[model samples]
Target: MEKLRLYIQIHQLKEQGFKIAAIARKLEISRNTVYKFLGMSFEEATDWVVSLGRRRRKLDRYQDHIVYWLR
Candidate 1:
């Protein structure tokens, strides 16, 4: 997720001697996110969860009247 991308960008910056602000601007990620991953290990970064939303939850099952009403 974002954390993994942050880790990669930070490491790439170190090897290229890029400035923090410049890297942050180019990467289009917040400065705080960049800084958080600055010295973090890959495993530490990868543990982040992108979401826990009920994206696959079917609203129709919960609201039978709504489905019939809409149809």
Candidate 2:
């Protein structure tokens, strides 16, 4: 996954003594994002990235109306 790749790249760059600001510039990502990825473990990053794809339920706004109608 692209997120995993980025995470790995951040780690590699950090290991090579790149500063956080430099990493952000090199990757064209925000410094906050760089810090976030750096602080996270690999599995944590994967879970966080995978969870980004989850969408809100389409009918969530109508749930109260639907329940009333059913009742």
Candidate 3:
């Protein structure tokens, strides 16, 4: 399924009161993604989906700066 359509369907499931983890299991995606969709406004989720598929990231990339700046 395409990302946008899937997003809309997930949004509906959320409105119907399904838990995030259950939706993720049914959809075969990550629990974090489901929870994130649950928390985001539609516009925010749209922008997020558009941005999410665009790149790779590593924890180490941000950790260095955070560790340097944080106590």
Candidate 4:
């Protein structure tokens, strides 16, 4: 979700005539990240973010145990 928001903001700033370096500074992100996001289309960005959510974390195996403990 956060990445999606950042991607949108990057594009908006770009459209508003902001330079890539300026956008990186304003957003406090690395220039490379800004470039990477700008290179992706909206649909591709959306899919990338969605795929991130679907990735398995190292702690994923303990998820059920963690939830059971919390309860």
Candidate 5:
């Protein structure tokens, strides 16, 4: 949801004539990230963000051990 909001905000700022560099500064994100997001369509961005949440992390195998340690 946060990623979706960022995508919308980036497009909105672009529509308002904000340059990529300016948008990066305003959003406190890297210029490359701004360019990457701008290059993607809204639907593409949504799919990418959703896929990210479903991707496996390297630490997944340690989940049980980590939980036990914390407890």
Candidate 6:
């Protein structure tokens, strides 16, 4: 589902007196995800979604090698 949709659903469910676990089950998402989004305003949710999209590590593909080197 789209981030905005998920955010709206979370808030709506919460307003309707649904618990985090119930929201998770009803939405087929994880409880952690429901918890993460539960208190965010629409603007905050949008920024979070955009930030997720912008998450591009400089060496994501070499993460395992980096870890091995560090060890």
Model 2 lDDT per residue over 13-65, tens place: 99999999999999999999999998999989988878877757889899999
Prediction 3 TM-score vs. true: 0.56
Per-candidate Cα RMSD to the true structure, in Å, reads 5.0, 6.1, 8.6, 1.9, 0.9, 5.6
The segments of candidate 6 whose C-alpha lies over 4 angstroms from its true place after superposition are 57-71
* Candidate number with the higher TM-score (4 or 5): 5
Per-residue lDDT for 10-48 in model 4, tens only?
Answer: 999999999999999999999999999999999999999
The lDDT values for all models are 0.71, 0.94, 0.78, 0.97, 0.94, 0.89
The top-ranked prediction according to lDDT is 4
Instruction: Identify the runs in model 3 with alpha carbons over 4 angstroms from their true place.
Output: 52-71
Which residue pairs show collisions in model 5?
A: none
Give me the overall lDDT of model 5: 0.94
**How many clashes does the backbone of model 4 have?**
0
Per-residue lDDT over 1-71 for candidate 5, one digit per residue giving the tens place of the 0 to 100 score: 99989989999999999999999999999999899999999889989999999999999999999999999
Q: Candidate 5 — which residues are off by over 4 angstroms?
A: none
Which wins on TM-score, candidate 5 or candidate 6? Answer: 5
State the lDDT of candidate 3 residue by residue for 1-71, as single tens digits: 27667778788887788888878988899988777666777788778777877767787579878898996
In model 2, how large is the Cα lDDT of residue 56? 70
Of 2 and 6, the candidate ahead on TM-score is 2
**TM-score of candidate 2 on Cα atoms, chains taken together:** 0.73
- If ranked by TM-score, best first, what sequence of candidates would result? 5, 4, 2, 6, 1, 3
Report the C-alpha lDDT of model 1 over 1-71, residue by residue, as the tens digit: 65566688688986799877888888887788777788677766665433323245666476878877889
Q: List the residue pairs that clash in candidate 6.
A: none
After superposition, the stretches of candidate 4 with alpha carbons farther than 4 Å from their true spots are 63-71
Error of 5 at 24 (Å): 0.6
